[model samples]
Target: MTDRTLYIVVCGAPLASRVGDGVRQARDRGWSPYVIPTDAALPWLEDQDLGGAPVITGNRKLGESRRTPKADAVVVAPLTFNSLNAWANGNATTYPLTTLCAALGSRTPTVAVPFAKHDLAAHPAWLASLAVLRYAGVAVVDPHDGSAVSLEPITSGTGDAVTQAFEWDWALDRL
Candidate 1:
């Protein structure tokens, strides 16, 4: 119901399956939520989801068919380790990542919340990519960084745990 649009990019994480919660939260916060799902996250979203906002897919062309509203800001929630690494290394293989890259290039207000097991975060490439994104002006929210979002490690396959642990609203507020 608001003019301001918040682009929520959902990556392939366990929490991505419940992205609806954050979409609703964004709406409650007076933001028109637009969903951009990474290739790996698409299976979680049903056709009727998102309350009719234009849903962008990863395998698609650069331009979406629908006349989507311009994003006032962006949030990539549950940013998976794979996606983050790809994004940081300038590999915009998916539409979601490509959009995020464009927003960063244009200096849009963008926030990314990485969600992965502790082991993934310990990877050298993952650590380096976090810095790359931060250096490019994205607010990368780390679970151990002692920030607003107190991220906890959710088991890889537990739907309930993933839904409960993900900081959906926290990521939305930053946008």
Candidate 2:
């Protein structure tokens, strides 16, 4: 069996440079890092030099992929607000969501870093969805403190505050 312990899934049009950095960070830490980009994210991945890491398209059977063998944990970085709502409601409309559902179903531990603006992020529905996800055993990292403006260190960067939810060691410990 392979020695991969972490699966990093990316969705949306995130910066290639930032993604490359995150992937490098995961590898430097000794975790076999595999980057899976949803269909929407494929074009972006194709444009970047991923340093030979496999980029699995979301349309395929993700659960059966070689990357899923013994994933100690799954992290969804820069999770879209829509994706967060879908996952919270058990809606697997996309490959990433489906894979997330499968991982959670198999009790493989999952974490999400939702990216959205302050107003959208604070919506009651969003909060409710987060509650449901947390209740159902999915760790939803809150990137904002009470102020709701500044982001926690882990979540701070380009794109959105949601990236904070996928901080490597922080999410790993939860798993």
Candidate 3:
């Protein structure tokens, strides 16, 4: 197995399941998974073992965490629209956003799975932010597509959507 560690960052409750799935996928493929969550996700993170991976909180430590030597890639699952906007605008106001910014700045391969309502998804600001992220070399996985399966409703966490986020192998291909 390679020494590379994949960092999984969850920004909210719903994303914890996605991160868990990602970790399982990574482990099944013989890769190491490191879990991290923002303050907003603390409640959920606390409930999970995350396969014994270290979980860091707060923005002050995020930059340092991103620079961890074994890191190979970073996955921001269930990335909220607010966090996405913050990251796109280079406004690292929170830990997850700060870690993402640090990862990008350090040339770490990062992928974001954005889960939002159709209206918010279609907003011009969101589109602009996505464009900025793409131009900056950050891959934004639009969970709206049928490719990534969703564990909850796409509209309000009550309706189901296809879960088709890129698998670990596909993600590695982008790197």
Q: Of 1 and 2, which scores higher on TM-score? A: 1
Candidate models: Cα lDDT each: 0.75, 0.62, 0.66
Order of candidate numbers by lDDT, starting with the best: 1, 3, 2
Off-target runs (Cα >4 Å) in candidate 1 are 58-66, 142-162
Positional deviation of 69 in candidate 1, in angstroms? 2.6
Q: Count of backbone clashes for each model?
A: 0, 2, 10
Highest TM-score against the true fold, candidate: 1
For residue 97, model 2's alpha carbon misses the true position, in angstroms, by: 1.0
TM-score, cand. 3: 0.77
Q: How does candidate 3 score on lDDT?
A: 0.66
Question: 61-161, model 2: which lDDT tens digit per residue?
Answer: 64665544567778776566677787777788876777777777777777766556656666677778777866777775533331222333223354443
Candidate 2 Cα outliers beyond 4 Å, as residue runs:
13-17, 61-68, 142-175
lDDT score at residue 11, model 2, on the 0-100 scale: 70
TM-score of every prediction relative to native: 0.82, 0.72, 0.77
